[model samples]
Target: MYHSGRLGIMDDGQSTVLHDSPLSQFADQTAEFLRYHVLSAVKLLEFRRIDWELVGRLGQVDRLQQLLGEKFRLVLDCDAPQYYELALEFHSTFQYIHIFNMTLPQFAMATGFYTQQEVAKPVFVSLLRGVMKKQQDHCVMKEDLARFWVTIATSPFSNNMVASDIRDPLYRFVHKILAATLIGRHEDDNKVNHHSLFCLMCMVEGRPANLASIFAWSMTRPKKGGGKSRMFGGPYITWLADNLGVFVDYPVDRMHTGPALSLMELKSFQQAGIITCDTPPAWSSIVEGPQVQPPPGSAADAAMQAAIPS
Candidate 1:
């Protein structure tokens, strides 16, 4: 029923719809395929290294027998507790970067991105643009990584709807999804995505790119059956407080800049369009009383717990 429609390849079992069209043939080189595969792998390997760099260092994992059994495609048997556990461990442990880089690039190479001299340059340019766009969409838009960190470190998380404590469950839930989402996917939004670079150009007296916020709201997660809540301890925060402060002098005491800026100071900054705080009820007003006692662990402890799930 289906035919390759080219030099003589055909498959009888496939539907007539399986016939490859010229669009299908020519579309393989674009970023859609690469973005899908890459982001899927990124989700699988959240907090892990990107694949393009790894392919040069190691061989790919191709043998399915180890994870899937002799049948290779059989559904996992619930009775097989050991294999079930193995499957969980496998999915949790596997970093899928290599699979993406190797497979997608192979498609691009076939389309002459890596071969034909004339088309290769444009293909490479397009590929770079796609990657840059994606990276911009995922990360916080600031003048630099430093500002990105500061914004996240000070963002509100918990309010009366969730808990009084700054380190509330809703906050963690939101950030966990956010960190993972940004870690996995990229998109093309020339506005906020391009902020840090544009600011950099401005610093050096170069022509700045048009920049805007990535979204109407700050980085936060929605509540169940309701509104959204902010998150803390984002990558930008950690990087800014620890690494970026050496240059910016943002006064990151108490592990973040929150302590440095009083409620009045924050309001003034917001009015000046220098920084935007999450809308009220402000973090202070959310709590009924004084601050909660520190949990069994400190912020450092929470970071470790996040790294390896129980």
Candidate 2:
């Protein structure tokens, strides 16, 4: 005979017992309910025809908020795909309020979604920090980084107090990416440079002083050969060459002076596409490769003959 305990346990004669704590049982029940009802509610709310007034009257929004609050940890920490889906759905459906209401730390954890939406200063800072830290991870996806940059460029975070607050981190991030590109460790160097340049441009927009510093930094970097070259080959360098007008006229005389290439030389190189190089081209080839002549009446002749016949 089996003996049952108050804690929902059964002892089958031996000391070995099967037990389920009431708390654990309650948690399991709660998870099941969320999996069914909460997830369904999110799905229903995602549809276009669903009336928001009706949804509010039905208390679906309140129910979702309650369920999400209860299962926040479970949904975020779980490795299951469905749990992630639920989190994303809840986030997208209630983005306006939920994103703004969450604390910075909480926003950081859900940056993958927050970054895709409009973000305020605190949320932007949190997302930027999250992306920077995530980029350091070995398994971070390029798409995630790309999305982060896109968000930064398109959002209103730039040209405001938020930009001033996050400027140091932004500069550090750009410097790290530039260093990687110079070392040739980055696989898609061109793409990385393009995104990085856009980010910097947005950051320095309406601020010529910041633009001057970035311009000087690019021009002052060591060249491929011995002395400093104005037209060094890199993504950032290329961007500077194209946007030379923005930083050219900035009065940097009062500011700290360094071993930067002169504005005249930069403009010359930009206009003439000429670089001061000591070495000549090595192993130059013709613009077009040697052409090959086809065999007289080869496959073409055979196909024509076959088409004319059977």
How close is each model in CA RMSD to the real structure? Answer: 25.2, 29.5
Give the best candidate by TM-score. Answer: 1
Error of 1 at 163 (Å): 14
Model 1 whole-model lDDT (C-alpha atoms): 0.24
Task: Give lDDT: candidate 2, residue 26.
Answer: 20
lDDT tens digits by residue: candidate 1, 1-310: 1112222111333222212322112133344333222222111111211121222222222221232222111111111111111111122222223344334333333322233352345433332211132345323222343332222233332211111122222222222222222221222111122322223222222221111111101221111111121122122223322332332432222111111111123343234232235553122222133333222343433545678867
Against the reference, the lDDT scores of all candidates come to: 0.24, 0.27
Model 2 C-alpha lDDT per residue in residues 214-260, reported as the tens digit of each score: 22233322222112211221233223222334225432221111112
TM-score of each: 0.17, 0.17
Top model number, lDDT: 2
Pairs of colliding residues, candidate 1: 134-187, 149-236, 149-237
